[model samples]
Target: MEFYSLLFLLLPFAALSGWWMAVRNQRKAHSLIFSRYQKEYLAALKYLVDDQPDKAIQIFTGLVEVDKDTIELHEALGNLFRQRGEVEKAIQIHQNLITKAPLQSGLRSQAIFSLAEDYMRAGLFDRAEALYLELLESGVYKVPSLTALIDIYERERDWTNAINFCQQLERATDKSLKTVEAHYYCELAQEVLNREDPTEAQKYLEQSILCDPNCLRALILSSELSMQMRDYAQAINMMQLVLGRDPSLFPLVKSNLRQCYLMLNTKSAYQSYLQSLLEISFTSPILIEITFELESSEGTESASNYLTDHLRKNPTLAGLSRLIELNTKLVQPAQKNDFQILSELIGSLSKDQPAYKCHNCGFTASYLHWQCPSCKRWNSVTPAVTK
Candidate 1:
């Protein structure tokens, strides 16, 4: 649809270029030629307006042949082909433009860039990467070429190359890429950790924190490393720092924090910390976790009472779901069935809902992402609805 629209958009440009080419040759003889093309242009536009863009595209592509010397016509046709997913045809058109004798330097560079784009659209990363690097070395389209190289490297999971190109892009565009670079470092850290190289992993995690001090992924990895090494105190401290930075991360680190507290015989301290969070109205997964803690340490009645009060202050689907769950457990044998049915209904409502969503594009997912998968924006995916 976008491709056909682009063809329709180029109709006037193609017509003007065709007319100009005919006038440049011999006005008297080619006047009829220009008139024929003018009628064809109006017909193509009518086809487009009538929702017959394929017919419009065919007419326009043929009209460009009226002035083969018109580079803009060829370029527009190439772009149309590319947008239509006919990358081979796009590449051929741009390649022909590059091979034209006496081509201007600017036109040559444009053709190369266009060809590289065709390669990218065709998923021929190696071919596209080579052309982009060539363009970069030529100092033409430096920022675009560097950006393309960064995307290609990232897609290939070549973190070393990705980091290098990302830094170059940052310098060329004067844009801060520290947050994205931090994710690259975290990726490296995870790779090292998978290889049982905790020492090296820690070094990468440190670099990540240096890039973005409040990097939650780095903190999470650091805590994991400490836990693997039996350093419960250090793990707890790191998670506490995470919660301090973003209380929304409480659910992600809750189990780890609980394990650390249990390992150190500090459940009471953990409970006190949770109570402090509730005091400030940090009702979220925190409240849910606290309800479970109360159920275990106190009783069903105590947990029920606490949730009932919390719900009065700030109610949410999750809070309502938990309240229903608690009631199901507290009710008598005959009454339990009704409460259980209500609990099941509430759970079904929220079960398919995602815990995280992209703030930029509104893409929802079950797990956390440092970069929004849909928008490709760094630090844009965040916890949804505080749970």
Candidate 2:
């Protein structure tokens, strides 16, 4: 049933349950309980009609104290409160249920888990962590509790604990967390790099690749570390490894790669790498980067001719933008203004287009993100190929 409709039905059902208890005076012990339910049910109806379903759920959950049969109803009410962002109310209901002496062990565990979720939603990570850890020790909800613990550690930026718990989860479930483990190591590498500890950063980066041999971020970081240490040859080799792993991500290391080649005075070698990358992945950004490199080495006319010929085979708005830019640089004084206008227009068209997108959630980004921001999945965001 629909949400509002379901809630409306619950009010009547709760009232009927109370009425039935009141009628059967054969159980005198239930008299006070029935009266309490009736009072709370009316109050809940008032809150529901006031368009405050959260408050109404709070009232209904209290009816669980009067009617044992209302345990499921109270659980549903707590979940509804949680879904509505009434986390405190949800926590109250779950906590109250779990504390009740006569509650079933299974139901109490369920309440404990639900309360942990409530804490998580409310950003009370400490509370959530404690409850999840308790659940983990109990060994009832091992996977979910461990998963929650991992998330809490990640949000806390406690990578050591996160990595440990992730490994624990992997061993328990017999599932691979190689990708996530690799990102954790990469994160550690970045932290060390920021502290100017290149040697330590290199170790973490190596661990990242060891965790997942296909970790693109590991290669990129290794390249950056090599460059920082003034090892241009190693940097270039690391970048080449990046290209071999995923040619579509060339733009990420483009500027750095160019600097490394120039530092080593290997312009010809840089051109050869570009040529090989273009052959493997026909992308506009790669083509444009190569055209600019060629323009610096071979002159405007040569670069313009090469780009124009390449565009005929593999056309893209970004390519057209570069072609116009090259032509603008080569045009005579009288026609230069017109070519500049065309170049500006093409630039505008490609400016807002993202260069990468999350394959899982369709989240678009101008730069590479090893993990998708929207879905939080590792290595799901890929380079967006523009024709």
Clashes in each model (backbone N, CA, C under 3 Å)?
0, 0
- Which regions in candidate 2 have their CA more than 4 angstroms from the true location? 1-8, 11-68, 101-104
Extract clashing residue pairs from model 1: none
Q: How far does residue 291 in candidate 2 sit from its true spot (Å)?
A: 1.9
| Local distance difference test values of all predictions, in order | 0.80, 0.80
Question: Over all chains combined, what TM-score does candidate 1 have?
Answer: 0.81
Error of 1 at 326 (Å): 1.7
lDDT of 2 by residue, 107-213 (tens): 67777898899999999999999999988888778999999999999888898889999999999899999889999999999998888799899889888889999
Model 2 CA lDDT for position 128: 94
Total clashes for model 1: 0
